[model samples]
Target: MKKPGRFLAPIVIAGITVGFLASAYKFVFSKSESSKQTTSQPQDSSNTSSSSKNSN
Candidate 1:
């Protein structure tokens, strides 16, 4: 029916939009989190080594 088609179009569009947004969000989130962990780990190790040297 014409009415069903009209309703279906918006639903399809919304589903596609949500899927695209979720994927983009996940991609960005993962990259940032991974980078943060990598960066933080080196800084933490350096700090610990410096502190140990100072104590000695």
Candidate 2:
């Protein structure tokens, strides 16, 4: 029983670590992609606004 518990402990710890890393990577990747989209769209909008103001 004690030997089984010791073997199980490392497996459980490894699984938890992998899950945590995967979630963290996903969170960071999504945030960067969203930032890229927002950044690109804002530049276009800012240009349009500036052009409209000049036209007026």
Candidate 3:
């Protein structure tokens, strides 16, 4: 029983660690996706100004 508990402890810890890493990854991925969307689509006036500035 003691041996079984020891083995289970490591497994439980690993599962919790994996879950935490996965959630962090998902949060970062979603943030990057949102950033891409925001950057790809700009307001029309700001878009023109940016383009004109680059042309100079």
Highest TM-score scorer: 2
Model 3 Cα lDDT, one tens digit per residue, 1-56: 24567668889999999999999999999999999888877776688999999999
Off by over 4 Å in 1: 1-4, 41-56
Q: Give the TM-score comparing model 1 with the true structure, all chains together.
A: 0.57
Tens digits of lDDT, candidate 2, 1-56:
34566778889999999999999999999999999999999999999999999999
In model 1, residue pairs whose N, Cα or C atoms come closer than 3 Å (at least 3 residues apart or on different chains), thus clashing, are none
Native-structure RMSD, model 1: 3.6
Q: What TM-score quantifies how close candidate 3 is to the native fold?
A: 0.62
TM-score of 2: 0.77
lDDT digits (tens) for residues 1-56 of candidate 1: 34566768889999999999999999999999999999999999999999999999
lDDT score at residue 10, model 2, on the 0-100 scale: 88
Q: List RMSD in Å for every model shown.
A: 3.6, 1.9, 5.2
Tell me the TM-score of each prediction against the true structure: 0.57, 0.77, 0.62
Runs in model 3 with CA error above 4 Å?
A: 1-4, 44-56
